[model samples]
Target: MAAKVLVAYGSTNGSTARIARTVAETLRRDGIEAEALPAPSVAAVTPFDAVVVGGGLYAGRWHKDARRFVRRHRRSLAGRPLWFFSSGPLDGSASERDIPPVAAVRRMMTRLDVTGHATFGGRLEEGAKGRVARMIVHSGKGGDFRDFPAIEAWADRIAKELDNRSGGGSR
Candidate 1:
């Protein structure tokens, strides 16, 4: 049977959610069974063979829902193959080079023994929720900076790793 993967995310402005969907779609295209869902919506992580958790960064911290999810599922997560991702940089720096996870995320990763992590560009467009978001958008600093190709490549790598672990040949 194909390995099942879950890509769960906590997105404030919906950008990270879209990125999580892209990752899930890429994994599906690579022959893995994958789905993306909001972090708070997931009741358990036990059903997935592997899990990728992502969140939008705000004020140098991960989205609250993501943090809570990891805390809530730490035991189950520690026993499974796990990865993490953050989407929050509003500039091209993420695409240009590696950006480490925030301090809290790093601590969780250590506790969970996560397999990998990535930082992708973020987006803050009009109609975003918070006052700060609206200010940024009005100031013309809000725009989509996500690199879809890079996101797909990262997801593809995860699929390959899962395939190897499942003893399935590369797709």
Candidate 2:
């Protein structure tokens, strides 16, 4: 059977959503059925064979909606391959500093029995909405730090993994 993948994200300034769409597109290009949807739209997850959940980091925490989505559907998620990612790094510095995964996410990842998790740099604009965002932007650590090549590479890995999992490719 062709593997169907769902790429869902919680985004504040649209960066994570764009990343999710790109990942979905990459999977589709590789002949997989994939869709990118906001976390809120995914009322259920059983339709997809695999899932990639991501969200923007805010004040050192993931968007509440993303966490809640996982919490709401963790039972179903456990029966499938699942991956998590966090996007929030200002201008490469956060990545360069070797920032660790969010504390809550680390615990959740263990409990969810997810396949894997990754972290990526994020984009920031000067006038980004929200008080915390504004303060961070005004602090002079703002720019498009996202690395497309890395994101694409990650997607490729995911596609290959899904292919292997679906019994469609030789490992």
Candidate 3:
């Protein structure tokens, strides 16, 4: 049977959600069974063979929902193959080089023994929820900075790793 993977995300302005979806899609294309869902919507992680958790970065922290999800599922997560990602740099720095996870995410990763992590660019456009988001948009600082190719490449790496671990068959 194919290994089932879950890509769970916490997105505030929807960009991280999109990234999560991209990860899931890429994994599927690589022959793994994968799905993406919002963090809060997942009742349990027990069904998945592996998990990828992602969140939007805000004020040097991960989205609250992502943090809570990790806390809630720590035990299940620790026993499985796990990875993490963060999407929240309004500039090109993420694409140019590696950006480490925030402090809290780092702690969670250490606790969970996450297999890997990536930092991707973020998107903040018009119609975003918060006052600060609106102000940033109005100030012309809000725009899509996500690098789809890079996101896909990261997913591909994850798929390859999973495939190797699964004997290169249906993972």
Candidate 4:
């Protein structure tokens, strides 16, 4: 049987959700069973063989529900395959440092011992907020920095990794 993977996300304006859905679709296309759902909507991971959790980053913090979900399920997830991702750098060439997070969250990621952690570019709509945001957009930090090809490649890699690990003869 194919492995079932859960792609759960916490998105404020829906970018992360869209990303999760794309990932799930990619996994399915690669012959892995996958489901994309909001982080808070996932009742349990008992039915999933692997988990991918992600969230939208705002003001250097991941969405609260995403953090809560991780904390709550860390135990059950201990021996399972897990990965994490965050999206919120409005600039395409920005580094990970450009999108910082609350210190405690960093510690949480370490504790989780995720198999992979990725940071993707984000998008800021018009009239969003703060002077800094507006200034950045004006200064050329606006537009969708999401790398769809990169996301698809990452999903494909995950599918391959899971297939190899499953040893069910899919390559």
RMSD of each: 0.8, 1.8, 1.3, 3.1
Q: Which parts of model 2 have CA positions greater than 4 angstroms off?
A: 93-100
Could you give me the TM-score of model 3 versus the true structure? 0.97
RMSD of 4: 3.1
Task: List TM-score per model, in order.
Answer: 0.98, 0.92, 0.97, 0.85
TM-score of 4: 0.85
Q: Considering only N, C-alpha and C atoms within 3 Å, which residue pairs clash in candidate 1?
A: none
On TM-score, the candidate that comes out on top is 1
* Full-model lDDT for every candidate: 0.94, 0.85, 0.94, 0.81
List the candidate numbers ranked by TM-score, top first.
1, 3, 2, 4
lDDT by residue (1-171, candidate 2, tens digit) is 888999989998888888898889988988889999999989899999999999899888998878988999889988788888889887675445555569988888889887877788898887688887888789887778887777777788999998888788953
Residue 83 C-alpha lDDT in model 3: 95
For residues 90-129, what per-residue lDDT tens digits would candidate 1 score against the true structure? 9999999999999999999998999999999999999999
lDDT computed for candidate 1: 0.94
Instruction: State candidate 1's TM-score.
Output: 0.98
Q: Rank the candidates by lDDT, best first.
A: 1, 3, 2, 4
Estimate candidate 4's alpha-carbon lDDT, on a 0 to 1 scale. 0.81
**Which of the predicted structures, 2 or 4, would earn the higher lDDT when compared with the native?**
2
lDDT of 3: 0.94
Error of 1 at 75 (Å): 0.8
